[model samples]
Structures are given as C-alpha cells and as structure tokens.
Target: MHFVVCLKQVPDTSEVRIDPITNTLMREGVPSIINPYDAHGLEEAIRLKEKVGGKVTIVSMGPPQAKEALKKAMTFGADRAILLSDRAFGGSDSLATAYILSSAIQKIQETDPIDLVFAGKEAIDGDTAQTGPGIAQRLDFPQLTYAIKIQELTETTVTVERKTESGRQIVQAQLPALITVEKELNDLRYASLPNMMKAAAYEPEVWDVKSLSFDTKKMGLKGSPTSVSRIFAPPGRSGGEIMDGTKDPAATVATVVQKLFQQNIIMVNPLAKGGKS
Candidate 1:
C-alpha cells in the first residue's frame, strides 16, 4: 500500500493581518506553518502506513519556502516528500491548484503506483474545500470528504465514518480513493528522535513546470478564473445603546417593549386585551 498525502503551508492565523493599503493579507514577518487540518491528515496517513506496512509520500505546492512544511511532514515518518515549486504556479486558484497537484501526482504514479490520497477537509487560509475533490475529479478517483474516522481497510475496499450535519455516516469505497479528513479524525504524534534527525538531514525533491506534463494555460494566474478582489477586516461592532430605567421605569419598559414588537423580535401576545391575533 502506498499513500500520498497532500499538504499545504499557511500563515499562522494568530499572526495573520490584512494590509490597509493592498487590502490583502500581510504575509511579511508572519510565520508559516503546516495547515493544521493537513497535519492531522498527514498523521492519519502515517498511521495507516504503519498499520499496512507501506510507504507514505507527501506532496505540496507552494513557493520555495514551503519546503520547510514538507520537511516537517517528513519528521512525522513519511517515507518521502516532493515539493512542487515554480513561479508559474503562483496566484493559482483552487481549480488551477488542483490541476497542478494532480499533474504532479500523475508524474509520481509513473514511477511508483499510488494506492490512496489524503488531504485536509479544508485549508485554513482558503477554506474553500474544493481542491481535494478537484484533484480526485481530475484523477478519476473516488472521493470521500469530511472523513472523521477510518472504520476498516482491505486490499480492495475502505470504510470510513464521514461527518455530517446530523451525525457521522459510514461510507465504503474501493481502493485508490482520495479522502479529505476532518481534524477530529486523529491526534498528531510527536516525532521520534531518529525521524527528527532524518528530517533535519533530508531535502525534498523539487519539481518545476518543465519536469511535469501539464497544460500551460491551466496554470498560474492566467488559469485562475477567480481572484480575490479585496481582503479587508469586517467592520468593528458599534457600542450598544443603554436602556436606562431610572427616570421613568415604566415608560422605559414600554418603549423597549414597543421597539421589540416593532422589530418583530418579541411577538405581541395574542391573549392581551388590545392585541390582535
């Protein structure tokens, strides 16, 4: 069994700020880390590899700096890491990103067959929840999203508990499927000393556009059908008005009740002598 986990590097949300001028995220001086949900997915992939006795490979598409995220994933005992970094891939939307990642995964499959693909349900930065399914669609693989737990796995099939609004549901699918996992699915483990050392010394394979067979029109900003027009903070809440009940307590109460009734926040009592049904 061979598993390929898709990972992403994102700005630490705690430190994220929007630029007043550009109306975009202020990334400078902000630290980057692996997308938290993706970390859980990586953990699940590692656990599955440990159980099935196979290799776990990690893939990420980002700028050169994103290599740090790939290396950190390696510290979790992933067998290999691949970084898809190129200027041509910049400013890609979810659709274009999925295309680039799927192309890279196909290239990877040419050398080593991939049996399963894992990704986070959503990225912290985007939260669109479309990239993983897009990859699955392009690869023509069965997709399972919001998977909360792995119930069972066999050579030909996999059963999972999928999170839903009412409750989780059990879903079974064939092998070579792609799954997007929820953070509640698993706890991330601390890397062992040996794996830590290995990660420190390891360098991931970097692939550029020339290395993979991909349509030039389906990459970068040109390929993106949508773009963020502007990013701004939501307006700050205004101070609440105080309803003082000192001067005329009864009158204040009546005024407040009337306002509530006018706004339909509090329905008028039909049983009241003067109230209409």
Candidate 2:
C-alpha cells in the first residue's frame, strides 16, 4: 500500500495579524508551522506505514520556502517529499489549490500507484475544509472526511470512523480513496535523532507549473473565483456587571428580581391561580 499525505505550512494563529491598510494577513514577520490538523494526518499515515510495510509520500503546494515544511514532515519517517511551487500558483484559492495538488499527485502516480491520500480536516488560516474533498472529486476517488480512526484496511477496501454532529459514524470505502483527518485521530511522535539529521540535509523535489499537465486556465489567480473583500479583528466585548451576594443573599435576590421586573425582562399575570404580582 502507498500513502500520500497532503501537507501545508501555515502562520501560527496565536501571532497572526491582519494588515490595517491592505486588509490581508501580515505573514512577513509571523512564524510558521505545519498545519496542526495536517500534522495529525501525517502522523497517522506514518503509523499506518509502520504497521503495514509500505511507502509514505508527503506533498505540499506553496512558495519555495515551503520546502522547510516538507523537510519537517520528512523527519516523521516519510519516504519521499515533493513541493509544488511556482509564481503562477500564487494567490490561488482552495479550488485552484486543489487543482494544482491533484495534478501533482497524478504526476506522482505515474511512477508509484497511490492507494490512499490523506489531508487535514481544514487549514487553520483559511478554515475552509474544501481542498481535500476537491482533490477527491478531481481524482475521482471516494472521499471519507472528518475521520477519527481507520477501523480497518485491506487490499481492496477501507473502513473508517468519522465524527458527526451527534455522534460517530463508521463508513467503508473502496481503495484509491481520500481521507480528511481530524486532530483527534492520532498523537504526533517526536522525531528520532537520525531522522532529524537526515531532514536537516534533505532536499525535497520541487515541481513547477511546467512539470505537470495542467490547464493554464485553472492554475492560479486567474483560476480562482473567490476573493476576500476585507478582513478585520472583531471588537472586544465589555465586561459584565458583578453583584455581591455573600453579605445579604435574600436582599440581593430581591434586588435582582426587582431590577428584572423594572427592566421589563420578566412579566407576571394577576388572573392566574398561581400568579405573582
């Protein structure tokens, strides 16, 4: 079995800021890290590879500096890493990003047939959980999203437990499928010394727009239909009023009730049998 994990580099949300004039993310000085959800997905993929003898490949689409993210992923025991970077890929929305990533994955499939593709449930920066499903649609693979656990895996099929609004659900899908994983799926392992040394010296293969067979119309900003009009921080909330009741509990209760009635926040009916005035 071959596993492909789609990874991403994102700004640390804690330090994220929006440019006041440009209304865009201020990423210049912000620190970057592997998307937390994607890290969990990658950890699960590596765990599965360890359980069953197989190869794990990591793929990401970003600027040239994104190779840093791929190298970090390689420390987790992935066999191969690929980075898709090109000026033509700049300003791509989720739809365009999925197109580029899917194209690269197809190119990779030419040499090594892929059995399963994994991705994070959503990217924190965008919080749009559309890329994974989009890739599945383009690859024509069965998509299992919000996966919490891989219950079973065989040569021909896979059974997974997924998170739902009410509870959990178990679903089975054929091979050559895509799964979007949640962080609860697995805990990440610390990289070994040897793996860290290897990652420090590793150079991931970089592919540009010319490397893949892609429709030029669907490659970059031109292919993206969505655009953010503006982004701003929400106003801070005011503190709530605090009342002291330890000294006089009954007095406090009566005061609160009277205030509620005076403010028209409560009503009473004099005609009812159990009515209060």
Candidate 3:
C-alpha cells in the first residue's frame, strides 16, 4: 500500500498578524510550523506504514520556503517528499489548491499507485476544511472526513472511526480513498537521530506549473472565487454585573427580576400564546 499525506506550513497562530491595508497575513516576520492537525495525519500515515508494509509520501503546495515543512515531515519517517510550488499557483483559493495538489497526486500515482490519501480536517489559517473533499472529488475517491482512528485496513477496504458533533461514527470505504483526520487521530513520534540527519541532507523534489498538466484558467488568482474583504480583531467583552444573593436571597431574586423587566431582557408574559392585554 502507498500512503500520500498532504502537509501545510502555517504561521504560528500566537504570533500571527494581519496586514491592515491588504487584510492578508503578514508572513515577513512570523514564524511557521506544520499545521497541528496535519502533523497528526502524517503521524498516522507513518504509523500505518510501520505496522503494515508500505511507503509514506508527503506532499505540500506552497512557496519555496515550504520545503522546510517537508524536511520536517521527512524526519518523521516519510519515504518521499514532494513540493508543488509556482508563481502561477499563488493566491489560489481552496478549490484551485485542490486542483493543483490533485494533479500532482495523479502524476505520482502513475508509478506508485497510491491507496490512501490523508490530510488534516482543516487548516488553521483557513479553517474552511474544503480542500480535502475537493481533492477526493477530483480523484473520484470516497472521502471520509473527521477520522479519529483507523479501525481496520485491508488490501481492498478500510474501516475508520470518525468524530462527530453528536458522538462518533464508524465508516468503511473501499481502497484508494481519501481521509481527513483530526488531531485526536494519533500522537506524533519524535524523529530518530538517523532520520534527523537524513532530513537535514534531504532536498524535496520541486515541481512547478509546467511540470504538471494544468488548465491555465484554473491555476491561480484567476481560478479563485472567494476573496477576503476585511480582517480585524473582535471587540473586547465587557465585565458582567454581580449581585449579592448570599445576604438576602429572596430580595436579590426580586431585584434581578425587576432589573430584567426594566431592561426589557425578559417579557412579563413570555410563554403566553396571545398578546399581552
């Protein structure tokens, strides 16, 4: 089996800043790290590769500096790493990003024949969570999102436990499926000394727009439909009022009720079906 894990380099949220004029991230001085969710996805892939017998390939699409993220992944025991970078791919929305990444995966599949594709449930910078499903749709693969664990894996099928708002769900999909994983899926392993050395010496294969077959119309800003109008910090919250109920409980209750009525926060006949006379 061959596993392909999509990785991303993102600004550390704690140090992130938005441009006042452009309303875009100011990456000039911000430090970057692997997307936390994607780190877990990569860890799961490497664990599966260790348990069974297979290869793990890490893929990322970003600027040239993204190779640093790929190198970090390689230290975690991935068999190969590929970076898809090009000016033509700049300013791409999730849809165009999926197109570019899916194209690269297809080219990779030519020789390796990938069985499973993995990605984080969502990117921190852009919490949209649409790119993974978009890639699966383009590849015509069954997509399983919010995966928490791999219950089973065989030559022909995979069974996974997914996290949901209500609780959890176990789903089965055929081979050659795509899975978007949450951070709860697995704990990341530290890189071994030998692997660290290898990563330091490693150079990920870089592919530009010309390297892959792409519709020029669907490559960059031209292909993106969504745009950010503004980005600003939320307003600060005001402190709440406190009442002394310990001294006079009944009077305190009455006072609270009277305040609610005075503020129009509660109606006199809120449960009444008809209008108040």
The TM-scores of all predictions, comma-separated, are 0.91, 0.92, 0.94
* Model 1 TM-score relative to the real fold: 0.91
Top-scoring candidate (TM-score): 3
Q: Per model, how many backbone clashes are there?
A: 0, 0, 0
Give the range where candidate 2 is weakest over 10 consecutive residues by summed lDDT: 268-277
Q: What would you estimate as the lDDT of candidate 2?
A: 0.93
The sequence of per-residue lDDT tens digits that candidate 1 reaches over residues 1-277 is: 9999999999998899998999989899999999998999899989988898899999999999999999888998999999999999999999999999999998888889988899999999998999999999999999999999999989988899999999979999898899999989998899888999999999999999998987879989999999999988889999966988999999999999898888898896789889953
Q: In model 3, which regions exceed 4 Å deviation?
A: 260-265, 270-277
Write the candidate numbers in order of decreasing TM-score.
3, 2, 1
Q: lDDT of model 1 at residue 78?
A: 96
lDDT (0 to 1) per candidate: 0.93, 0.93, 0.93
**Model 2, 60-119: lDDT tens per residue?**
999999999999999989999999999999999999999999999998889999999999
**Per-residue error at 151 for model 3, in Å?**
0.4
Model 1 CA deviation exceeding 4 Å by range: 238-257, 266-277
| Candidate 2 residue runs with Cα over 4 Å from true position | 250-277
Q: By the lDDT metric, which is better: model 2 or model 3? A: 2
Number of the predicted model whose lDDT against the real structure is largest:
2
The CA lDDT at 164 in model 1 is 95
